[model samples]
Target: MQFYLDGYRPGDPEYRPAAPGRDESSKGAAALPDEVDVLIVGTGPAGVVLAAQLAEFPGITTRVVERRGGPLEIGQADGVACRTVEMFNAFGLAEKLVREGYWVNEATFWGPDGTRNGSTAGITRTGRVQDVADGLSEYPHVIVNQARMQEYLLEKMRTSPSRLVPEYGVEATGVEVLDDGGDYPVKVTLQREGGDTAVVRAKYVVGCDGARSAVRKSLGIELRGDARNHAWGVMDVLAVTDFPDIRLKSVVQSPAGGNLLIIPREGGYLVRFYVDLGDLDPADRDARKRFTFDSIVAAAQKALHPYTLEVKSTAWWSVYEVGQRIADRFDDVLDAERGTRTPRVFIAGDACHTHSAKAGQGMNVSMQDGFNLGWKLAAVLEGRSPESLLDTYAEERRVIAQELIDFDLRFSTMMAAHPTDPAHPELGGVDPAEKQRMFTEAGRYTAGFATEYTPGLLTRSAEHQAVATGFPVGQRFYSAPVIRLADAKPLGLGHVAQADGRWRIYAFAGAGDPTSPDSGIAQLAAFLGESEDSPVRRFTPDGADLDAVFDVRAVLQQDHRELEVEALPAFLRPVKGPFGLKDYEKVFTPDLKGGRDIFDERGIDRERGAIVVVRPDQYVAAVLPLDAHAELADFFAAFMQPAAALV
Candidate 1:
């Protein structure tokens, strides 16, 4: 799974163009068609994820445009957080990316004098901090460059049923949102690199085109935040170094040579150095123009002095002025009074928010932005949900963007100041202890785990919060190991909630009551098997494939051998494949590794079964009593098109 880029180094005779079809003109190439359902700008992490998700809907047509001629092979953001890996796992790409990248298990820290600082340099380990998300996910922080990550996603999109192919060497030069109600409400002007121009219409458009987003500018959106006073140099290099923590993720603060952030990349020999370039006037054009490979590598050498460091080869390098900014709104228009607004033109990722890439979140958060928006957009486009559901995308993600900016603002300043600078009296310059505490605390948010959304049409009241105390409303559902009752194979509950874009209902059947017909689990199963009028049936539109829009799985607290698959109600175990010869996935048991129970891990009572509703993106939407059929039916009716209405 490890990937190697050959014959394409900078200035090489065989070097490929940054983008393909860069020399092709409209006269030679086919012009863009008049319309597409979803037109996405930029093929970065956000754009590719958006394209891939939109391809899932058969009725929707998705197209992505990138200015680059081809996918990048290296450089930029690295570090896939635990939650992001869970998302990739849900979509069937986590294992592939994990295999191709290095899993960062611990972080190391160094002080001004090149001495390790930690409680175990007798007090703490300088280069080995505790893993922040140790129990949060099965996956660890992975170090795959953004270029490679996008390539993986792009390949997935290419092989998908929709066969989505992004348009390269094409850029969005203009966007016009049509006020007149029509099938295609957005007009986008695309220009190829060779001066060929064409216009394509779309029901919706999204900008994932980095900080210099033409889409955002065309839509008149403004980014609100200030640029930092410091500049930084980042380089991906293959090097021979005597530094002991070269392989570990290390944060080194120097009193004179500037701070250095070391990130070990996929290959064991390659490392990324993020060197603080000290204070420089943002308005000084000449100073900014002086950065080069030699200057950047010199910075890295100075930061790690006394330890001989020699760069054998460099893959990529860039000088960046650190800053934080977020769009005032994710969408172009907002009309709350109408209860419906055209989410026609949108911005995400760097187009919506920009921060220093040192946190390894630029690409991760960007991909997640698409992750959060894709399902909502798909639901609306397919008439599965109302337009109002679309508004929640901006509402939920904007807050996260602002929070990220705030964190980076503080982090940039802390890292920019020298370890011995007198200006920062609070800690007498960069205090390694304080920095470690803050960095760990920030990981909770940066790792994308503890983010809780507000209650909207998707989330229900907090009254039932006690039912699944560990799985809260409007939060991504936590995972725990569970054994399949039919086979006794252990697996995490999240594996069943894969990112297939389906609403999931988990019926935790607490210690089965075969003797009582009216008991909680029995009553629920009876309702499901009764008829098409069952609450479960109401969730799906008439004539629609039941599994296409939603999934229902039972988690029973019963021993694998003791439980008979035939004894389970029809609803708990649906039949599928070749004239119903095969059973759908069987109910899972709470018992897991080390005899631990998932019910206990999630704070669910083994005697009191509960019904948990999970959104398409796997956020826990609601938790109700097992017998709350009426309430459950009403819940689906809120967003889903009723069977009667569909007919």
Candidate 2:
């Protein structure tokens, strides 16, 4: 939210000033570039997010091409996780999305009343629980159309300095990785509607074209998993229902009929239902053809039992068989043990993983995949980091994709299973109460907050976990209320982060006054600001803003009113922008007005203090002591390149 440094624009400050020769007017008027730093395939959640992130860096030449004629209008995935909302906030789109989307606060469960003649009776309310656990995230689990989500991201890209716009009606037909070391090492072949083809060279390629990705086929990667043989009919409809929990997310289990999952859409009148269509016969290839929209409605009517549903109109409906699959690898390097080779091609979203959508993780996880890889790609292409930094994309995201598939398999199985049958002892059945418990427990995972990257080049070991217990080294940086020392404005500490391809170093003050020259924070700030080997001094380009490559900020233990902003170290209040304006929003204190002490809430050691380093994507990369200046420099040295070297 820092602004007015570039002589004050009248419009929104979030809209960055357009780069030279790059603006909304240039979109589509300029011919396609023969070469680009990155070429992304598909306009889905993954590709759009990646393109949006790259748009922030005008120096990076990025292009996104899609097979579709235009933007997605309707009929696709919804159900946005809380973590995804946090990412949207980083891109400055969360506010609009939350205002438009439906918040899922509670969920109710329904099951048959009692066993009758080896079957269940009429359905009855079983249990009700909170949809997302308290304190999991500041953002709520939202239900919005995937098309709308992409529209917001695309808008961000269009308004960015690069004015990035996807080239529609042109699709990637093939990909080939080159052996010789050149600026553009990957070749991509694209085809238009009229059968005209063109070839483009790129430094890197990302395939987000979905389950039947042609780029993935070019790489010869196989999606390895099994189909559950169960089929479910999903539909978005405007309907009148006697079911009390129609607005609330509900799971209905009927032994005599089949299972049903009801989710209310963003609009108050629209709702979506995943009606169980029973097990699919392996031998029958045309089983899905036999079930139509009318059959889906009939199945929903039966599943509700005594309750009734009068459908007014159907917005979108489809039949899908339950299946869980993940690609063998996400990058171009096939054999890891052979030799050191940087990845030039990658796959994300449904292009790399496929699973049942019952867990509401498809779109959420897919967007995260793009977020995880976007910054790394930008850094490498800008010469801020080495090409080896690209390897971590596959290493980290592949594990998360596998975990999603495993969880989805278990969750979809429970939702599809029938209630217990007393007469049929041989056939195992799902207990209604147990199913409810599982749903409540899986909230963290489904909300996208449970992902933790393993220790690697990007993440540090938990040896310093005692420094900042709340900000785990390998997980997303958790936010807490903080008051701006300069303006007394209250906001989340994590809200300061923007997807601008810069690292974050949060220096929490110890018990001693941070203004004192002898305090731990003062000494640490001096080292980071003045030392020759400090990451800030070495990685930042000559004459650039002091916080250009690394955004260093401080959090004090005392109230903002008690502290003097002028007395803080220069690094904590660095001069930036073309006008050399002193950035005042960098310093923060505990949110006294909100009655929350960040140190106490996040388990920060007030006596010792801590430094939490967060990546561009908002994941905590390292947690260290306030005076661990050497460790801080060493951590960044592993990945970041010295600015002088690029010159």
Candidate 3:
């Protein structure tokens, strides 16, 4: 028998773990694989997160390419919404962000010409901005640079079981969809740093290559939208200032200078400023040059007339033109064959949509765009879902992109307008309340919590509306605390709905006897536990790990003490992990004695509870009466092959 470390040769007796992120290729690292399950272009936040997600699936292999040498240093798109934070927590990435970022809970507003000479009078007012995401999740908005965000995601990918590495200094020149119908359908041509080109094949290709996407262009997808003709100068600065709201998330409207959106960064002293660079002709090269670092800082100082402004140092800066555009389609196939659409090519993040970064949504929404597509691709490639499942990526994400564009058009128009500016007549005479309402209303959309998919496969039920709680179908399931019956551990329902690629079936088994013939839990246990041709058995691949395909959990209304592992149904008991470790958290109940009531919060009835199905992406797929096992089977059958058929 022989044992060796990753970097050691056969003769080496000692073993040492390879250094993190070392370019092992220079030290005998293997060359890139000839084929992969997924080929991701552009190592931006979206591409990296997508790769990280695909890593969760044991059989899915991913190869990512970046035109740049490495991660970006700075360019202000740094606000992580509360909903995005909750997603990070589900993936165990929230703590890292919390430690490296600052939270913005309240926003301050300075208006009606507060600036006098270079300093402002005492801060006029502060508004509770955090309320926008209140009740949506326990997490709050975080501010971290896009670069750091990518680094964190990349670190996670490197440590993942897949150990995927993003190939830098490599550009994807072209992609062609093949009609051969073999497993790999997309052929991509890669241009290395030395001007050498190589071709690789992949089952699917995802373009996260930003606004100027080569893949999207190659697909002939037209991005539709009108240019807003609005341009803004953004800069990050560490400074000394008398401006009271300098440290807060603020909208400052100067009487003479212009409008400025201020965002405080992670380190206490660092601040980002978004300055309205009044309408310059698109052909005006001289005016464009004026949109520089020194010029932007001067504009900021003028905006805060009486507030003493001093730029100690600048971390980064840029001038971006505001516009609203979305690609016509997110996923597409180059050639039509045999009446079937091969959605072998897809685009996400900035490749699909682009808008002002003022809302802190660019990176958040981009990463989520990848998140949505990642699992769907993984499931289809692994044979857990049909090819048609990929169609929903375009259907669901295009709607979101359109909505985001619409929201940004309205919000940006308002932000770019000064009360005295005649160019934006709509916002010229708007009052403070109306302005605040606009911010808050748009905040809801920007938070990313309001995103809801139309009912489709998985989300085939409309019964959620009739439930006591207003939990809607085709939406991400909200969180409510419940106690694990076995160990009495308090856990948030949303936290348990991790983004691991698996369907989660939560059976709300209302209080009843363990063996009662009419009890929903008893009936469920009976139906799901059958060894031959069971409902669950018909939903996954043959001989596949059942727990990996479906995460079955029970929310019982009974007292915790009355239900033991041995007393419950076979399917409702603790499942053994890979190492034979027992996972007792699968069954939960409201801690009535502790005054926590999840059933009430989720609108689930204790008398006749519901069975809720959540997709791998954590979207609520279906909600039905507990005994509707047939409907659940149908939901799976819509996209999956039966186990017996697989044999």
lDDT of 3 by residue, 318-416 (tens): 888888899978877533431277488999999989999887777888888888888888878777677788877877888888888887888888887
| Model 1 / residue 368 / CA error / Å | 1.1
**Better candidate by TM-score, 1 or 2:** 2
- What are the models' TM-scores? 0.90, 0.97, 0.90
Q: For model 3, what is the error of residue 644's alpha carbon versus the real structure, in angstroms, after optimal superposition?
A: 10
Task: Give the clash count for model 1.
Answer: 12
The C-alpha RMSD in Å for every predicted model, in order, reads: 7.3, 1.7, 5.1
Show model 2 residue runs off by greater than 4 Å: 29-31, 115-120, 336-339, 644-647
Q: In model 2, what is the error at residue 133, expressed in angstroms? A: 1.0
Clashes of each: 12, 0, 6
Give the worst 10-residue stretch by lDDT in candidate 1. 22-31
The best candidate by lDDT is 2
Tell me the RMSD of model 1 versus the true structure: 7.3
Cα lDDT of model 1 by residue, 490-577, tens digit: 8888876665578888888765563256567767777765655565566566655445566777887766666776666766666443
Choose the strongest candidate by TM-score: 2
Kindly state the number of residue pairs that clash in model 2.
0
